[model samples]
Target: MRNRMFAVVALACILVGCGGCSTQGVARQFADELGEVALSAPPTGATYYLQVDNARVIEDAAGDVDMPYCYDLPAWSEDGAETSVVFRTARKLRDGAYLRFDAALLRGMISWEEVGYDELPDAVREVM
Candidate 1:
């Protein structure tokens, strides 16, 4: 009975592991959003409003670590018809990366998420 249970659990683990990396298909989602916000049907290249600064490094048990980094990504539409915003950051450089904000990604400031992540108290959300 125990052998049978172990085999079943092992098979489940193997199947789960086959899903591979976590951040796949990200480009496709971005591409779809670009189509909506572009005049050229897919945004012929982009001018990113990204600014990299002094990111922190944190290490934990099991030797797993996180490089603390955060970014504020906003966009101005062609012809200036509409403006959209997003706030992104990493609590960890790996799988924990995420897009988190509230109330439509406000004017690059006044976000509780930005003030608290990545061991940074005063990032000042760079908008390029």
Candidate 2:
């Protein structure tokens, strides 16, 4: 019984330590998700201001930037259509940069499965 319990506990730890759900780890998370993103590691020292806008990618002077930065589905997006939304950041990030989202501000928005550099859902602004 003890051996079995130890095995389970070890497995759980392994899973949690290896990036389960929370997208916190700066370098590893960015590497898996946005490899083509041109940015440095996310800003470490300064607290950032975040609110959901149409599409805005914030940049830092010390060589960090963040996100494919998408928001606000197009008017034509709908239930069963392929929708692509694009937004441009004011500045570009250097290599190894990353964008971080405001978890608190993004409340009720950003589905777990839908978070990616992919097509936006066609749901209307009200629906989003």
Candidate 3:
């Protein structure tokens, strides 16, 4: 009985440890889903945004630049069709301002481009 209980506990522990349901895991899964949708030919288009709300901002693991946190999710058309994959950063900038990005350059296909701060959205500016 003792051996059986130990085995059961060990198995449970292993299963719990193996469960990949952490926030980071969820984010990675989301990124993966976006990648799949991006690869597929969507009719309207797909936008992938990594959002960090409020004062908390996720730093780019590859570099020192802060992530373009946004309140919106990556926009993709419901109907699968060929369209542009636009990447944007809507993050709060220094001095009570926000840095934004444009949809001119299609990104997130092969790599992400570093865009300069454009301007804060009207609503965001108003709030600040």
lDDT of each: 0.34, 0.32, 0.38
Q: Compute the lDDT of residue 119 as modeled in candidate 2.
A: 38
Top candidate (lDDT): 3
> Distance (Å) between predicted and true CA of 107, model 1?
22
TM-score of 2: 0.21
Per-prediction TM-score, please?
Answer: 0.21, 0.21, 0.23
Query: In model 3, what are the clashing residue pairs, if there are any?
Result: 42-81, 43-80, 43-81
Give one digit per residue, the lDDT tens place, for model 1 in 39-72: 3223233222122232432233333234233333
Ranking by TM-score: 3, 1, 2
Sort the candidates on lDDT, descending order: 3, 1, 2
Off by over 4 Å in 1: 21-122, 125-128
Candidate 1 lDDT score at position 51: 25
Q: After superposition, how far is residue 118 of candidate 3 from its true place, in Å?
A: 24
Off by over 4 Å in 3: 1-34, 42-57, 61-74, 78-128
Q: Count the backbone clashes (under 3 Å) in each candidate.
A: 0, 7, 3
Task: List model 3 lDDT by residue over 1-128, tens digit each.
Answer: 99999999999998788775574675445445333334443344333222223354333435324545322233222232223232234444343223232222212343333323243233333333
Enumerate residue pairs that collide in model 2: 39-96, 39-97, 40-96, 40-97, 41-96, 66-98, 66-99
lDDT of 2 at 70: 34
